[model samples]
Target: MQAHFDAQQRQRSKLTELGLGLSIDIVAALATSAVVAPFVAIIDRSIISNASGRMPLMAGLQDGFRTLATRPAVLARQPSVVAVFSVYAITYITANASETIALSANADPLLPKFLASSTVNIAACVYKDKLLTHWCSLGPARPFPMASYGLFGLRDSLTVAASFSLPPLLSTMLQSNTSMSKTSCDSISQLALPCMVQFISTPIHLLGLDIYNNPSATAVRRAQVVRRDFIPSTLARMGRILPAFGFGGLVNNKTRTTLKRWIL
Candidate 1:
């Protein structure tokens, strides 16, 4: 009889443990879904609207506001809610926005441009010293230290590419008049008034990324070196890039109009 009672207690404990774990998992999944759903909805709506030549901005605004309102409450109660929202916001504002702006403006696509420029610049910088040493060690003196000069030239090439690509992309994404898809716009409108709430809340997402991914000392040191030594030269080579990016709205308008005409 005692053995039977002990067995029963053991079974009960096991069941309780299993239930507890399952409960936690369920809550986690629910939280994740809640955060991701908004972002996914926004992206899907934006893409459909853009592809169909409809406006999606209102929808974005609506969604943004709704998210802002609910976010604080959800985060206050559950910390994980904060993380999920942060990821969604970053993905939407940074990656998705860049894509949208690029497509709308008819500028070089953001992904390809950023990838190509970053690759070239990183490669040239990494190899600069090595290449110079190889050339200089060959003899008393080479004709003009072509390798060292070539590194500067490669860096210049990267700057030119970045400048050409960054302006229109940023402009189109940030423009106020750009529209969202009908579905997304509807979703936004349904959220209620005071859409600015979302905009105010959006910065939280940016701050999260900066806090989470901030560089270590090594990274800061390297960036500092790059900025000090390489930035000026690159800027001179690609002067047009900064102007275009700085006057984002104007560039966006020009790029979008040009693309629209070309496509039509």
Candidate 2:
């Protein structure tokens, strides 16, 4: 009888911990997304606008802020803004839940964290890419090619690695040799890795957009389009990625850690 009572208590305790952890994730995601989403949306709008040749980059940026300042309601209503918020919110929920579970089980968290976030990131990013590209283009929207999904999935996998996996490893390496403070090491790793990864992922993203916009364009023409927009699009993506993954990831991590200490 005592053994069965103890087992029930253990199960209850586990359930309570999970509930509290999920609550922490919800709070952290809400707080972080509130700040990060608008910035991410603004940059996303600019990048898609430039890629679609709908407007110059600078003009797209100005228009983003101007809309925020003058017509905040409309900015809130934008599909880009809604998508960005959803990604940030869902990412935190999954990442925090996975990390909490791994820690409780005394397992390495890096792989589980990467897997948890990458799955959602790939799906959400593919949808967002196609939606934003179509919305930004002056041309009528068309069905997305199958290749576009694969390209976005690849790009987002890299992003998930940079955001979730590389930072802790890089921070540890930086601390071991550089004598940097842990906070400084973390900041540098979190900021630099995700931004640098944009170099590789941005071209993949642009090529995907080209495929969507010009399905019949030859390989030579698609390559030309990528080359033409490569520099500006890469720079813009680096900017967007820093806010979306770098800064946003930091904010979500800190918030969840703080709340876990307080609540869990």
**Pick by lDDT: which candidate is best?**
2
- Give Cα distance to truth, residue 206, candidate 1, Å: 29
Once fitted onto the true fold, the runs of candidate 2 whose alpha carbons sit more than 4 angstroms away are: 1-7
Off by over 4 Å in 1: 56-264
TM-scores for the candidates: 0.24, 0.93
Residues 179-237, candidate 2: write the lDDT tens digits.
78999999999999999998898889888888887788999998898898888888878
Deviation (Å) of 173 in candidate 2: 0.8
Evaluate candidate 1 by giving its C-alpha RMSD to the native, one decimal: 24.0
What TM-score number comes out for model 2?
0.93
Across residues 1-264, which tens digit of lDDT does each residue of candidate 1 receive? Answer: 999999999888766644543343333334433444344333323322322224343463355447646784543343223333343223223322344445545675656545544454334423432332222232342233333345434533433343334434433453544565543432232221112222222232222212222323354654443344233222221222222122222333334435445533
Question: lDDT of each model, Cα atoms only?
Answer: 0.36, 0.86
